[model samples]
Target: MVRDQREIPVRDRLLLAGVQLLEKAGGGDVSTRAVCDLAGVQAPTLYHHFGSKEGLLDAVVSHGFRQFLAARRDQASASADPIEEIRQGWDIHVEFGLQHPASYAHIYGRVERGKRCGVVAEVEAMLLQALAPAARQGRLAVTPADAAAEVLAASSGVILTLITQPEDAVDPGLSTRVRDAILDSITTGSTSPVSSGGEVTTASAAIALASTLEDAPTVLNDAETALLRDWLGRIASPASSGARI
Candidate 1:
């Protein structure tokens, strides 16, 4: 098997070596020579395959994120409740970081706002999918996009903070507290479309009616219905405090 690895393409060997280093280092960085030595490849071979150290790091990060998403995909498929599944996702995300801090940090610890990563975007897309069923049912307080953004920010921040501290010194409730609070702000606690209020939440009411209108015949034409749906979305939006449907 070791000889088989040595015979594989240089890029694959480099990724395997980098992942091994990340596991051993616990979020610390490695030198180019270390990766080259682990792969039994020359420095020129590494550079030729990856262009630069940063490029190799990017590939390694993408690889780790892909594996993370794959596990999440299997879990999601076996579950029926979207809201509960979303909460479970938060826990899974934190657990992954604890298990592989170095690989996880490369994917989420950075503070770059404008940069684009396809793997990271896929994670957010999955979150949106989890939230979609609730949103369609008028159980979401905010748009799926807004809720996803909040979840991503809070979960990543909590993991990064935990990884920065000694494992035993970290607060046990921090991740759950942050996750639940953010979720409450975006979704009704129950699967029911309505909140504790008399009928339904204002946002949910508007959203439900809009969806009903979409399904049934209406006096409004296509253009009017489209505009009305847009207006309902804005009213349901958390950022639009004064908006009316």
Candidate 2:
């Protein structure tokens, strides 16, 4: 049943109006007057609910991001190979960008000087969560945090590039190619030729041990565990050669 618009909360109505106008505008300029009219509220009501039109738009973008994250979490498979999960995550990220170009642009394409999008940290955290499993299995060449950063940077770049290209000119294989290259650079799987000898590097061992420590109980106390992590970090660091500068 189509309930009376009056029954809806003013805040929700404003958000719905803002998102509709934003999609209609192709993520371009949207005037407060138009949004207020669409929401059946006066200018002051919008301000009361959202502070300003810009604030409303930020809320819309945030809402879209939350929905995406929830859906991704629901669909994610826990038992899948970690590397494969990362690959699927990359594909999903790209697909979301393509399907919601305007919203995606707001998240990653539009940039302000020295300002970071709030959603980026959450995205990176998700990547870190996915990489933890690989780290535990000695499949990661770098720490989970490092790998997450690399993947986020590369994937965001790919999404922006794809979104700007003309529909006919978009490269079908670009996403997959870039995804594989970045994955290969950061991961050392048992099936990978470089890992054929079943030998683990000092850094890889340190990474795996550090990751596994989180899954099981340890005899060390908080301070000792912290010190141990510090030592492992030093071992895993590429520049930790004990050289005095």
Top-TM-score structure, candidate number: 2
lDDT per residue as tens, model 2, 93-208: 88777888887766755688997776677788888988888887777778899999999999888988988999889997999999999998887645432234544666777888
TM-score of each: 0.74, 0.82
**lDDT by residue for model 1 (126-170), tens:** 788777767667777776777899998899889889888886798
- After TM-score superposition, the amount by which residue 63's alpha carbon in candidate 2 deviates from its true location, in angstroms, is 3.3
Off by over 4 Å in 1: 32-37, 40-52, 72-77, 108-110, 116-119, 193-199, 205-229, 239-245
* Candidate 2 lDDT score at position 7: 96
Q: lDDT (CA) for every model shown?
A: 0.75, 0.81
Lowest-lDDT window of 10 residues in candidate 1? 191-200
